[model samples]
Target: MASNGVEKVGVLIVGSGPTGLGAATRLNQLGHPNWLLVDKEADAGGLACTDVTPEGFLFDMGGHVIFSHYQYFDDLLDTAVGQGDAAWNTLERVSYVWLKDRWVAYPFQNNISALDKEDQIKCLAGVVDAKVANAVAQGKPKNFDEWIMRVMGPGIADLFMRPYNFKVWAVPTTMMQCDWLGERVATVDVDRAIANVINNKEDAGWGPNAVFRFPLEGGTGGIWKKVAKLLPPERQRYGCQLAGLDKDKQVATFADGRQVAYDALISTIPLDITLRWLGQSEWADGLQHSSSHIIGFGIRGRCPHGLKCWLYFPEDNCPFYRVTVFSHYAKKNCPADGTKLPTLCKADGSGPDSSEAAEGPYWSLMFEVSESNYKPVAQQPTKLGGSAVAAQGTWPAVVAETLAGALATQLMQPGDEVVSVYHRRLEHGYPTPSLGRDGVLKQALPWLRKHNIWSRGRFGSYKYEVANQDHSLMLGVECVDNILFGTQELTLEHPNIVNPRKNLEMKYTREPVMPGLLASAKPMSAQEN
Candidate 1:
């Protein structure tokens, strides 16, 4: 600690998630020592972290699979936690959408052939109409709903796109924008839809995450914990909350009364919260976000959903929009097969025939439910883990609802034994792309930059298109380069460019000199303070 409890550094990074860690890693790799990293959480990996139940079951905050679009990100993870089968499990994506009581192949627009005869006719006709309308369309889609209609027509939109998205975003499609749908969504092909329906073929592969990797152990958070290890521990501070920011003075005050003055501040905090701290809460109205309710169940039995990594839910039969076979990702996700455990409840949420502990195999399911002002969720006391008591309308009620949903979706049996239950609610889950998002960001980001502050991260920049783990990390890395050398931040500025293809411009190791980042144009001095 500096004397007078006022430390000075070139850059002060807030939040130790992927983005903050990425910024720190880049600064260190470039040999910049006068910087500090702090996070409110006791550990790194913000929303990407994982939680384990007392019965020995691990669950990530949400579905986080690494599908890297940058070689730098790929290399960082490889260096942090070795490469190949030893450190990761490379799995082919086998995803589906559970609707109409049947499993539809993923990229539902491309696989409408899985529907019944009448439904197939309805969807095929819509695709044909959309293609015809698109050929002579007047202007681009005004909102997400318009885009869905233009690409998928009314039948597909009415059946799946609208309902599924409403459940996922917890907001009406009409209230959201469409520019962020670069590669995140799959557009329907009129001819392909027709051909698939005629031949009864399934078009499963469409988007970027066709094949992805998961850490062999410790879940998704394990990867970041290892990445944080690569940085100097003395420079990293965990469990430090930012009380307020003095942008004009270039100083940050912590809740503990510790203050740090920086030449340039790189903040990964949510843009809305940052604005509020800066006393500019008026600009935050344009920013919209949805909350997430993650529920997990550890059951004693052999895995039933074989090779089925994840499945989506669209109907009212379930509360969650998606569920992942967590144990299928890795065996270590569950307790040892022989480990003894008593049943909490049957899949129907009824009392078990016997409460005696028994040894057996184990499997787990993780579910995600979205919530927002537009879509309110049942608020109740959250269940932490491990034999915690929960009554109706609390964690137990939520779990009961989820189990009933599973049974309704045929993912669970009525008498299945649930050994462990876990539930956690993330206040800031997904950064929504609202209709007025771009307008607000255009002003707020530049305004922050003028104050020597760089707001970049999942919620910092608030660009859902580039808010993935890899993109979030690069936001930090690119911000550091921009601050030091005036280098263009591609991931932040040109998400469409960096997202569609591999970004090989930067490397992990300082090897061949890279162009475009002019040293003479370097702005801030790391040793200024």
Candidate 2:
């Protein structure tokens, strides 16, 4: 502990992501001013951060689309970016699946026309069987696999859901639970699927996020970077990593050797990391997570494919689950017109066998792959000393595999020139809905609360249902409401309850938005006995 004699804050937040910022914003709105927020990164926006290549192409960590279920979330974003069309580019989602060597309209389950006659027959048979079983069954599915089999049947499951989900989750469908599937997974309409296959018709306009907006200037990271600016600067800390926490002392130690004590600590760090910080070895030992490798490639010329977004690789030719036409989000994401650049290498890291500079207009794509103990990523060689082109290794065999898969799926031509590349491995990417996750959280949350610590966020609470940007922001806002007043944090305890339009009336407007007038204004620490 520092020699400041127990300096206290009403609340201390451990992350600057949407959730943490939401809490801070709500506390500020309520006028309970004694609080502080910290993040490990140099700026705000956790997974939402955007990266820029040397060639001037911009890509988000992953493709993130904006769709809000909460008015408060909408209000906060609008306030951050200003309520104008100039800050955003709204486009209808043009997404598809590269299956059977062709483009199939999205919600792969509904686009059987894209598959061959045999695959179509298998899928319809399974769908019919699942419908019959569901109509007769009176109990719930035992696991995610069973739920998928019961709803989509073995044929569709074998074709799309099983393989695609395994690629995304880095775990077999049997290992996951079924409860998190609400609204996230699209259920196949048996009649429509069969009709489309019969008539060789492509199904269109399916699922959520049919249309979404992207930030025009700063990329996805710009949104949160802007939101962080709205908060009182004195209360926010960036680039300070939490080294440890003393629950009994109500203190959090930073990597820089500074210590801060608080009446309550709201942590948005990964729960396992939080446990290790608190020295709860036993609890931390039980938590597990899958890592993710995000790869971005900048290429010259207009997009070879007309599709805006699509899912690829059901045959395991590569490691990625999805690839996005990142350049489609914004032209500024690439170089300005007439600028020339050469193809450095092939997607597999192979070259033209000559040291040459290529030239001009460029486009980019982003891909995400999951990794874990069950699905280990192969290693790849690296050139010494940061050379743009060097001898390659196979540790990231997935990289080469992905390159091959992209070509096999027709995402890129065999000779497509790769101008710029970006790759990063995130330790905790998607929160897995494992069999023991909910139980671990159930025990861990109350245990932490006994020490005045509130762990919440995508990995904070480990709930995937409410883990998107809108839900995440609301989680923080609601947590503040609970801490400052006695308001319920609906997004935290009940995800489905808060999923659809909870408080649209509170959305941001030109007038300064504040929480409810009756919301408590007294600082929690000041009032604590």
Return the TM-score for each candidate structure.
0.93, 0.91
Who wins the lDDT comparison? 1
lDDT per residue, candidate 2, 110-140, as tens digits? 8888888899889999999999999998889
Over the full model, what C-alpha lDDT does candidate 1 score relative to the true structure?
0.85
Model 1 earns a TM-score of: 0.93
| Model 1, residue 303: C-alpha shift (Å) | 1.5
Stretches of model 2 off by over 4 angstroms after superposition: 1-6, 340-342, 347-349, 352-359, 382-396, 500-529
lDDT of 1 at 42: 92
User: Residue 359 error for model 2, in Å?
Assistant: 4.8
lDDT of 1 by residue, 1-529 (tens): 5676788999999988899998888887777869999998999998899999999999999989998776667878988888899999999889999989899999999999999999998888888899999899998999999999999999999899999999999999999999999888998878888898899998896777888899889999999999899888999999899999998888899999889999999998899999988887888888999999999989889988889998899899989999999998888999888899988877776666676889879999999999899988875544322224332124745566787789999999988888888889899999999999999999999999999999999998999999999888889888988998888887788877776633323322222113212233232111110
On the 0 to 100 scale, the lDDT of residue 392 in model 2 is 30
Q: List, in order, the clash count of every candidate structure.
A: 0, 18
Where does model 1 exceed 4 Å of error? Answer: 1-4, 381-396, 501-529
Candidate 1: Cα lDDT at 268 = 88
* Candidate 1 worst ten-residue window by lDDT: 520-529
Residue 482 lDDT, candidate 2, scale 0-100: 73
